[model samples]
Target chain A: MTTDGSWRHTAPERGDAVTISVDGEPVRACTGETVAAAMLAAGAAFERDRSGAPRAPLCNMGTCFECAATVDGRLLTRTCLIPAREGMVIKTPGRL
Target chain B: MFDLAIIGAGPAGMSAALTAADHGLTVVVIDEQQRAGGQIFRQPPETFAGSVLHPTAGYGWATELIRRFEADPRLTTEFGWSAIGVLHDDAEPDGLCVAINHPEHGTRMIGARRLLIATGAYDLPVAFPGWTLPGVMTAGGVQTLVKAQKIAPVGDVVLAGAHPLLLLVADLLIRDGVPVREVAFAQSIPTPVDMLRALGAVPGHLRMLTETGAILARLVRKRVRVSSRTIVTAARGTEHVSRIELARVDRRWKVTGAPREVAASHLVLGYGFSASTELARQIGCELVFDSPRGGWVVAHDERLQTSVPGVFVAGEPTGVAGADQSRAEGTLAGLGIAASLGRAVPAAAFAEAERGIHASTRFSAVVQSIFEPVRGALGDLATRETTVCRCELVTRGELDDFLESSPFVSNVNAVKLSCRTGMGPCQGRYCENSVGAILASAREQTIGLGGRFSAHLPIKPVPVGDLRDLDAVTEQPASDGSDTGRSAS
Candidate 1:
């Protein structure tokens, strides 16, 4: 999996690094980074179709809702609109 | 209760709030975004280490406006609050209520003596085969990811669209070290004569021209392929987009050349913008059709007050004329609101604001003329198999079939009901405009009739549990001094 430092052009200078789990897999993220951003940075699909097809984040704005995923048991939460926190559990589409 | 309640914290709302507050008027600016800057000047998170300011020149003005807006004591800024519905009573004086929903606070109501709806606009909906693919998105959407979130999508990206914003997004992607393979514009590059005419139309706006020139120069230096009069006919892929097909089109957007395929991991498409007129329409504001102004816009007077008195509209809600125009209109509306409330505003100040508005509107007209999508362009790209409404899985064929079979179904709302085209989580924000266009063309009727869809309460999606709790939230009594005993019921 791609780390935040792999595809990033500039070094992130935010607060302490945090770990957020996606489908029980730990991913590294910074404090201010959004859940969608963290997943994209880590090269993980933020969504999946009913047939288990991987879906990337489109329209990072909350309007599209293409990046919606279950966060901490809440369904349809927009990952792009919410900031990532330590130990947050995210279930992508089709995972449930 | 606020003396003036402004929706949206973009250039227009912020300017209006700042101006109104400077006059000692109690004001509240409600915005859906977490920060004060709306889409154009959206700021990064406070903990974000990257520069909060936009890299583009002249945007520094936005930073100053945001700072002043937050520091002003008279202005109460409510971020992460979406204005769901508006209630107005003709029987009472200044009887206007704005229903706002906050993630943590549930639903709450705020009363205002005067209201300014500056909710702004979103990307125009353009449907095509494979548009629902994970990698396909609007140019503005991708720009937000890079500018506000500082996150770039991995792999090769292509910017395909009709507006000047495509160039801007491409420039940002290149600056952020994203692999932008090409920048494709649906309209042909302006001829020297056209450029000269545009410049002549907006005589003093040399900075606008210089900025465009600089972006083009950088793209040239980076060897980014720039094509014009080419449109993405289809985005081809399985779960995610892997490639796109481009076809040349004429001024009327009719296909004129053979289609060619290009490898791409991400496809960004923008066909201008559509005004977010739901709030204004909810309050029964008069709307008029003008393509140059980005479809239907709230009809307002020189003072920026709508036909409904004490109700004003600024920013993209009035028209998609960019931030400068929004700010100018906002200032005029603020002054008008203050004057209505018996506050002393100098006539000279009003005149100065009017002059600025006139200049910016003129410049906007010129830009709109050049960038407005060609009529029928979207319809031409959308095939029967193309997904028109992603939320409902409604395809172009289904809509066409519905229109063909149901002779009584003539408007957009009926289409929405018939096939659930817009009854999804997005609430028709993404597909209504495109569906309106297609239905209009198929029925041989003007697009305006199909474009008029009434906005219901809870403009954004709210859970059923939260909506049920709305009744429990105590409603604040009307404090505008002329209450007709409305209790937010």
Candidate 2:
């Protein structure tokens, strides 16, 4: 199992995985995985702080930008379209 | 120009331009792209070098109209010119002189009696973490890159997200030899009862189903798995995309404990789009909000007249519609604008336009219902950290606080004033609906006059540089609109 205690190393054919932190929790994700997909694997659904409404990945890709979170101190990073890195720290904007 | 100056040469704008010009009105159609067809009916670069569209139905008709319009001596089609601004002329009533950045020729100002804007819409991409990574792209952008550019998005791609357009895109990808690992269809399929109800919308429903079915068939041929009721929870990988986690949702759409992950190299995401209309607002068109139709839209009558006289609209800019509807409405709106300008539209033409518009609207309503932005599916509402507008860097809490403090409670304009949410480069295409939905939910009231949201103008963002020097643009470019319509009809 990887960090954040969600994803585990599967098999050799599954390909190489990478590690990143979501809202301060460390998680390991696969290579080429979008930040949103990795977060979902790590059980991180609510990517942003809720402003009196629940916020999840709306467009799931780029058009919505709803899944934007702080990555390595940069705000408004789209997790769905962004690929994961080995040591990137993601901040959950509007985290409860 | 005698009357209206349209900014685009695509279906929406061309429809209006041809219609307006036929009414003994001088019209100038300006576009940034080398030719018409926008992105929807985009053809190969070589084909557009001089080839035009055909006049037959089945998509070929668009080429035909272009050919006929090019032949119209009264009309001036400025291909490859960008509209800089709708310069507000103080002297003219409902008059706006447009500054254009003509491609080869310098800038020029064209005065108009009125403007018929059909700026059209763009994809609305919701930014997720890591979305800026290289492999991710909007479904439309991906399709354009592949179909128009002949470039593959990636080797093994995961085509995910909702919207009927995505299905078509996935099919296109497979056909293009792009390896699609799996399709994570976000919007759940209609329930059996819902499907049956949708059946009443036979033509519309059939259209959507057929498109989806085509994608499915293509995927099946390529042996790609199609997963429904599944939401991509997270994406993982190294320098590129590698794996995606899928969560199975219950009947209530609650993600179950069971989580599954798949591997892929690239991710294509596009939920859909709202009416992109920022230019219309700059010209002072009235707006109405209808949640079912996405965010704000321009106010136009059955004749497609805006609050400003002589201006008209058609196609997705009015709201999202399929290609056939857009073409139909485009044709009708052209006729309507012509009639409004005193060019008598034959009774048959009016009827035909009405029928096309009606059918498109019906389908649009169904699309709205199917893609409804449900509340709880988002996330915790109390957090102040989540971003609502990625481009503006406006946080969710900031807008909420502004809404609570401002007098324009629950109105997006007021909120925009307080937080600059909708004032970003992409305008409000991405976050308007979420904001509208939030406002409606917060006030516990329906949007607009009758459970609808307010529609605003210029539904999209006009380029700043395009407006820098408007006086140098050319007044005329294409001596005549030509119809060499050779791209796929």
Candidate 3:
């Protein structure tokens, strides 16, 4: 996704970057980007509900838990609240 | 224990912290976000170097206050923490105790002589067909993503609903190069006379007037279709938003035509906002229901103190007036706290703060009158097939069936029990009000009866592992008698 270049932000110069794994695939994002933003940027889907239907973030704020995913073996981790970190493993409903 | 402890580091909490510190009061504030500015002055990640080109809604004053609040040594802010439980019993006698938890840090009990719950508001969610799709979001939520993260959807975007945030966010999206197709409003276009009247009532805030005019002028020049009496009938898509449906409404907001479909990858809805009053209600501070003025807000006295003495409330928790009102109330609350602490208050500063409150009130009234949602607007939006409770996956049809079979189902809490509507991780923040509206239509009970559920301990979804260490915390038993108004939604 980052290779597509300027798909999201037109500004060519991004700040320092971090690498994290989303749905078992390595994704590069801005250093301080949230897991949800990184996932959305990488065109990845988040957790599935009890019905197994994919849920996207309705409220990017932490209050809405729609974007909850498993990060580093911690289940129910809100993607919007936690910042992206190096080598963090994120598990989502849809495979990328 | 500090002299003052505040929840939410938004405009109100940050302002209160600054005023308290200036008056020689020790202050500490906690916010769920990682920064001091709440939604209005949402600051990007400190590490992100990108800059936003435009400022909206008190950007200047809020920016200055947030900077001072962060740099002031006397004021301390604990970010990424939420108050889980509140205890104000005989144990501390000094003040109330707030139990907080973090995803990384386990749990800690903070005690303060005086407490302020300035927890802000969230986008009011109204369910409709295809609303659960991935591309649909609250307008403010998208604003945060665009304003803070500098990310925008690459495909077609549509902004719909009855809120000023829609206009502002639509303008922001266009500036960010997001292809926004249309700006739809459920309310009729505010006539020139209406705008003039509202503006005339609050003539001093010329900056706000000019800024709004400039945004509107730019939007008009861009040829972005801004239509009134339009409502989002449905979003048509499977997993992500592929298209959206728009319909025309009459003065009473009744659907008068078939929905017109348009291809869209993003849908931003801003129907209204509900105050995050979980902690306020949990502590038994009196709450009243005024739909436009932040539903189920804390009932405070002239000094901004909640029903519980030594516990003060300001900002959106008291009502959903924007940042301006919040700062005024925050300052007044700080002054009240300093006075209680036996500090000499500056008479001139106190008068100016009061004047600010009155001016904000005037502006708030105008904004409310313009952006208020008509009852008929939402009455016909969600269908029986729509998903009302996003957390529990309860559809309107399923809820209606439960209500039909179950005897004496009344109030939002009753609906929650009937089908586990509000039992999930969200704890009814998304579905409570929508379900309450359904109940009101069904004649079950009033829309809001002390929120979707009673204010319970551990208001947030604390990781199960963290609760194991809760055995050592003290418990305070407080009565709900403090709440004077509790019936209406």
Candidate 4:
């Protein structure tokens, strides 16, 4: 996965960066960043459908539920609603 | 039981809480989001190190409202609480119960003597072929991704739809350094004559004019293609959006030319917003169909109180007049609620709020005339195979077939029963407006005034575990026989 930060704009300031696992691959995230934001910034798709088609986050508000992922073994957690904590495990549906 | 309960933490709810609390009424404000600023001025989490600058010019007012709301001791703010249902009790007569669900708290019921619903609006779901594809999303969704999450969908992005919000979203994306390939507006930019006429009603709309000018300048500088009187008829891609088909449309939004395909990775569709009246409808608020006001807004008197006594609606729940109107209505409702509770509210306060509301309403009327979705726009774009209801995967063809076969299906609820149009996780929030339009058109009836199905409880999807917890709470016999009917209605 591309984690070069091409999609991320430099903010005026950033919180402390921490590492989180996406599909068991370590991805860097800033404190207070949503899991969905971290994944999108790191060039990771939010989830995959039964057809193995990658789905990106839409309606970053929790309404769409399109950004749901398995977090720390729990299923269908809304990544957009969850703050990215250090060492948190996020697995996309394709990985599962 | 709280003296007052406000749903949604947007400007309206926050302002109401502040005004009511200032008048000595204890208030509890509940919101579904994790924080107080609601969508317009949504703030990043406290843990977020980056500053969240307001995208528009009214940051001062929003910041002041949020600051006062946070500092008020008499007001309790509950974040991450989704109101699922509103219940009326004969025993309490004037009091009502709000069923709320939190991830940590499971399910709980809060009783309040007065209920104010300021639940805002959501984007009007416009169905066309391939709208169900992964890469297509509402423009508000895109704005949320950028504003709240500080993230943008990578790759080529194009915004297609009607409404001035499309311009605002383009400005936001451009500011965030997102590459916008094109923006296709289904309605042409207001004619010079129209703009001149509208200015007479809203001379204070200088901020909007400046903002629009800045956005247009940036779009021109960046070489982003802008097409007017055009609409996205279809999205073409295998897994996600790869290209979108656009066609020119006339004033009524009827296609007048051949469709053209444009390469895009993400397609943002916004045809303006629809009021979230589900909770109001569920609690028996009378509704009126006003398309320019975002369709089927909960009916309210001058005091913002609905037909159901003790229940008030402000903000977009009453109409889509933007934040200023929301704040004005919220202040008025707060004063009204305070007076109803026998609190002393100065007469001048009501006059001031009414003046503000009148000015804002006048400005909003100009906006609605210019940006409201053109009549027959959605139906014009909808194809037989186009998906109307994403949650239930109902297609336009299926809806048409059902309407033809079941002649008795005159209302939205009957259509839901016949084809499961709204039986998905969204609880018909996304598709109800479109389906209502389709139903009205099929019956050759003018699409306004009446014909909405009563919204049911559990307006939001809740976990079975939460329901069980609620069951446990209700199963305990009430101390009095009067509480027997308090179980889920």
Candidate 5:
């Protein structure tokens, strides 16, 4: 699996991290970046499709709707559009 | 109610917002992104607002536009909001009510006195073998990740597809120290005569030509020359893109060479874009097919108003013209909206906007002519095993089987309902065109709007939570104003 560190920014980091749980496990994410980005950063899949194959973000933009995950118990919330807030909980369809 | 509620905050939406606001209209701009710049000038998250963004192009305009937009007190910007549908009632004065949802705001229906659907286009999804794999993504999508979220691709990135944006993206990523494995252009390299003709096609845009030349030069210097006449026939991997299969194609994009495999951890595709006609179509706006550009574009009258009067569409909704045309159209639409709302917009401003539109439209047509066509039998690339629908994980074999059984299936929507091709959460944004193309090929007929799935509302999947508590959510005061976005259905 491609690790979260595989994708990185050219910009230097200055902000502190926010703690958000991914699939019930706590993951520290950069504030203001998206939950989907944090998932990519953590090398986590967004969710499993009905076939149980792992699905990550494809469009990154809102058009594809592939990045929809459960955030704060809101079903099928678009993780790409939702900014990661402190103490936010993101639940993806469990990995197979 | 706001004077105007714009659907997208991309180039056209932002421009329209500014134009409408400058005309002293209380404008409400709703977008899914956190910032005003659309995909073209996509900004990083607000945390990185302090960081110096890598300027590819349109940097100055975006920065200036965003500064003015954020400073304006009259404009209400709703970021991270996804539009669900439009409810147009002739009985009410809600000028076609807009329904939108956010993670925090839940779902709310906003009423607009005037509506402008500047909903921009997205990268066209091209289905080939293993294209649905985890790491195979839109070329522009990768750019969005890198540009907006500061997330760059790791290891061997192979960008495939026949669009100028591929070269520009290659240049952007390479400049930022990302290693690109190769760029596979599905079309042949342009000859000197072809280049001259293209230059002639853009009579007023020498700067764009020079900018493109510079990008090419940088790619050459970085030893990242594009492989012309080549197309990615397949991607192979278990978890992520591990190998990409390539083959040379003729001028008509017919596969002509033995396929070769290259090690690739990722694949970026730029097969051009399609019109985001969901919102416009939902409003019952009349649509016409514009094959070379935006497909199934909304039909608009002289004032940019759709068949549904008081409803306006600009940018990709009208057609998939680029940012310049989008911005010009935004100005035209904004002026038209103001005039329609009984505001006295000067005639000279209308003329200037029209002039701008003409110049940009010429440039858009020229650029599109270079890249949009020549996908000859490109749809034929999807073999029996390829996954045509990404959301449903429906394979070509399944689609073919369904088609064979329902031999008289006249349109793609039937295939969508019977075979579950467009039933996924995405509502077929990624698969509709490819599925339509395959069905068209199966029927041996040209694909038309009829051959495509009719857009159903909520255009995208809306959460039941958004749908459940709508009556309890009162008219939330937007931007310190009585200007609420919810439409009275």
Candidate 6:
């Protein structure tokens, strides 16, 4: 869509890179990093609802429970805590 | 009588006393603590000996300020005295009177030409499941144990929740050689790129992160493991905490299927901080709700002046920044007071104190990134049998029924009337946030967004007997006076 993976700014390294999907579109991120980090690097806002409401990571570890998104067909995974694994299928729960 | 009377011996209060005395203002500093230092800078009793040492002592800057105040002949320090109420004596010009409850001496009214309210804040009480357990405590409580009491709370501690203080306590525990079974770092929320874009103003952000990193590393070094994205759902114990149920939350923070159980003797939960402005509220200071700071804060300006003239707020009560910022703010407030009194302070002095405001901006943003009020989590506290008011042994069932059935129980005041939840000795510090959260969570269902609770006074429980014979009593009209002007509950 844009570099930064989303069109914001391009990343310089790829060692942490792992592959996941954003609204069915494939994206790459680093290993052991959070989905929020991946999404931010990709320049995605991490909003999951179809309402187009803007959502970003609040409370980066987990307490706020705000950075949730579907991971590997699982509903509402805390992107801030889930480690990036290669070939992980992500779904925007609004679609299901 | 001292030329200046300062309330609340926390960092702000102590610094004000020290600064004013140095500037030749005869000063008296009063505090509720048996010793000096507020909650953030709380130090242990002088008698305890241990292998552990704090990297920085309690009220590091306040301690330095107090030392200066002690040497100044113009200052008198009063410890263990709680300010009962402030009475404005209309009969005497520029004269304000305060009734202080001294533990041994009893209540006494002191008059001062100039009053500086450095009275610091208290923790916003947020209740949780099994939060009433003896072994379960606020992060500030745990820090008091490690830093002030030098006692290990338990053999194995499962430290959970969000907030910088949470990480700091975990670090202190690790440094003290206490075994932390699991550092469940569950304070994550979705970060917007826009949020991080404002990071330039805060220099303390990296330091807080570094402190957290160091604690994480120390835990690892001590053979303790890190478990991020997890929360302790239930703490199980007979007399004390013996087991905890850990659950995984996805992005929206809903628990996934099946939780894992961990056995431990202690469980510490710290969500974040609340403005400890009960004293401010008691004196009729209006409160403003700032989402980032948790709970109600006394509305102040760029210079730390409050809505009431001659009153100032600094440190955590202003908002939850760290020690350095508190010290800077305390000094800035002191200088402002001095300047207001027509005393000259060099322009450079003001600029120097301002560095912390800039430094704390980044830190506040980062801290804000980590820990925010767990919006709907308190709804989980509403199990029918769950204890809402542990002090009064009131249950969630009782409160709900009161809200639904009792015609008089329409709002928080009415709820207080029907149930003794906020009427206990610890006051509402343990229940108000939970009560508000339960209401907000329920409202979110139909209203689309959860409503918030407004803070009130006497924010702390004042013994009714303490109010008699206090001459400076002034009464405001019967208005809610909260940021929302009404309680959503």
Best TM-score among the predictions, by candidate number: 5
Model 5 spans > 4 angstroms off: A1-5, A94-96, B53-55, B89-94, B201-204, B373-376, B469-489
* Residue B430 shift from truth in candidate 1, angstroms: 1.0
Higher TM-score: candidate 1 or 5? 5
Candidate 1, residues B211-253, lDDT tens digits: the string is 8889999999998999988888988887568888998888777
Model 2 regions more than 4 Å off: A1-96, B47-60, B66-74, B101-107, B197-211, B235-243, B250-259, B375-387, B395-409, B417-420, B438-489
lDDT, candidate 2, B1-489, per-residue tens: 345677666677767666666555667776655556666765334422222222212355667666666577666666655454566666666566776553224355666656667666666544334443335567776664444333344357776665666677777777666667887766667778767666666674464566566667777878888877666655565444567666776644456767687766567775666665666666667877654564567778887777876667666667666566666766777777677666777998789778977876676676678875443343222136546675566766776677677644766666666677766534666666556555665666665521222233222233244344554432322334331111111
Q: Poorest 10 consecutive residues of model 2 chain B by lDDT?
A: B480-489
Query: What's model 3's lDDT at B319?
Result: 84
DockQ of each: 0.41, 0.03, 0.46, 0.38, 0.57, 0.01
lDDT by residue (tens digit), candidate 5, B1-489:
677889888778888888887787878888888788778878776577566444455434657766777777777777778788877645465555677877777677666788898888888788888876788888778888877777677777889897888888787789778888789988777878778777765665666677888988887788885799899999888777789999988887889989999887778899888888888766788888666785678889877999987889999889888888888899899999998888889999999999989988877887777787443366788899888887778898999888888889868788888878888788888888778778877888776744456775678777666776444322333665534544321
What is the TM-score of each predicted model, taking all chains together?
0.92, 0.70, 0.92, 0.91, 0.94, 0.72
- CAPRI classification of candidate 5: medium
How should the candidates be ordered by TM-score, best one leading?
5, 3, 1, 4, 6, 2
Clashes of 2: 105
- Position B124, candidate 3: lDDT: 84
Q: Compared with the true structure, what per-residue lDDT tens digits does model 6 show for residues B147-175?
A: 54444443677877755566677777776
Q: Interface root-mean-square deviation for each candidate?
A: 3.5, 13.5, 3.4, 3.4, 2.4, 21.4
Candidate 2: residue B249 lDDT (0-100): 68
- For B73-176, candidate 3 gives per-residue lDDT tens digits of 66656788778878864666767777877776767666678898889899988888888888889988888887777777778888999887887898888787
The best-first sequence of candidates by DockQ reads 5, 3, 1, 4, 2, 6
Query: Total clashes, candidate 1?
Result: 0
For candidate 4, give the lDDT of residue A70.
80
Cα-based RMSD of candidate 4: 4.8
* Model 5: per-residue Cα lDDT at residue B332: 91
